[model samples]
Target: MSRRLITEVAGVIEAPVERVWPEIVRTVPRTELGEHVLAYQGGWWYRGEWSVTPVPGGTRLVHRVYDVAGQGWAVALANRLFIGFRERTRRSFAEGLVHLGNRLGCATRLT
Candidate 1:
């Protein structure tokens, strides 16, 4: 059996959640984040369930790493070799949001 790692990052976007959602969405895509994100090959991140939604706190990005047959090894490797993946992914997404927000019109700066 393999366990998936799930986490959330909340940030205020000068624009509404809907406005910010699309920019945020792109970073998770392989093309946008392929350089910075780890554990990815080709144009996919990992075999998982994902969603973005609006909530009282802010826009919520949810990602789940799953194990189904062949993916069992990936889950195990992620656990053993990349235990810090959750934090890394969180930071990557956060930084990406800042950049996207800037490009999309918001001038928020992570630096």
Candidate 2:
């Protein structure tokens, strides 16, 4: 039996998806790469995905974290014990967007 817990954060970068893709690949290496998508798996329970899409002004970058655990109860318990996990995830994603914006010399806003 497997269960998934997902968390997501999105930001818009003042650049095209083409420009943002390379930076995402550079920052997050050794992942399963696809058109505007990067997938990473860690340990046996965690999967992280980064994706970009063309928006009105620029590109929308979204990060999603998933806990896909066979032992769903254990994962749930662990998450309950981990204080501020969701907040930390959001903060980290925001910081990453800021860094990526700096690298691209563009502005980024969390959505």
Candidate 3:
């Protein structure tokens, strides 16, 4: 089965679309947000990508990660064998977006 996961963050950044996309999509790790932005807690590391777009009210952030495999028999029964993992990833994205919003909002002096 093909596995897909999508998460969106709106109003996540106060900076202009031009100003935010670069940092948001940077390949390097940012200390402020921690280097393990997308690492799986007790498993092998995997690569992930993030996208940003300008929406009517704010910017939209999207994250996609792939090739995630399950550890045991439980996963065989699971639809994607990575449901919990994807959920954790979703939470991580939400947190980073919220933090990014606060940082950019402060920088932009947007109340």
Q: Considering every candidate listed, which one attains the maximal lDDT?
A: 2
lDDT of each: 0.50, 0.84, 0.50
Q: Which should have the higher lDDT, number 2 or number 3?
A: 2
Models 1 onward score TM values of 0.49, 0.87, 0.54
Best by TM-score: 2
Rank order (by lDDT, best first): 2, 1, 3
- lDDT (10s digit) by residue, model 1, range 1-111: 343444444455455567665664555443333422222232233444444556554444444454333453466654685578668866876776577667767644221
lDDT of 2: 0.84
Error of 2 at 111 (Å): 0.2
Kindly indicate the candidate among 1 and 3 with the higher TM-score.
3
Measured with C-alpha atoms, the lDDT of residue 87 in candidate 1 is: 82
lDDT of 2 by residue, 18-59 (tens): 999888888885475778889887776777889999999999
The lowest-lDDT stretch of 10 consecutive residues in candidate 3 is: 33-42
Query: Where does candidate 1 clash, by residue pair?
Result: none
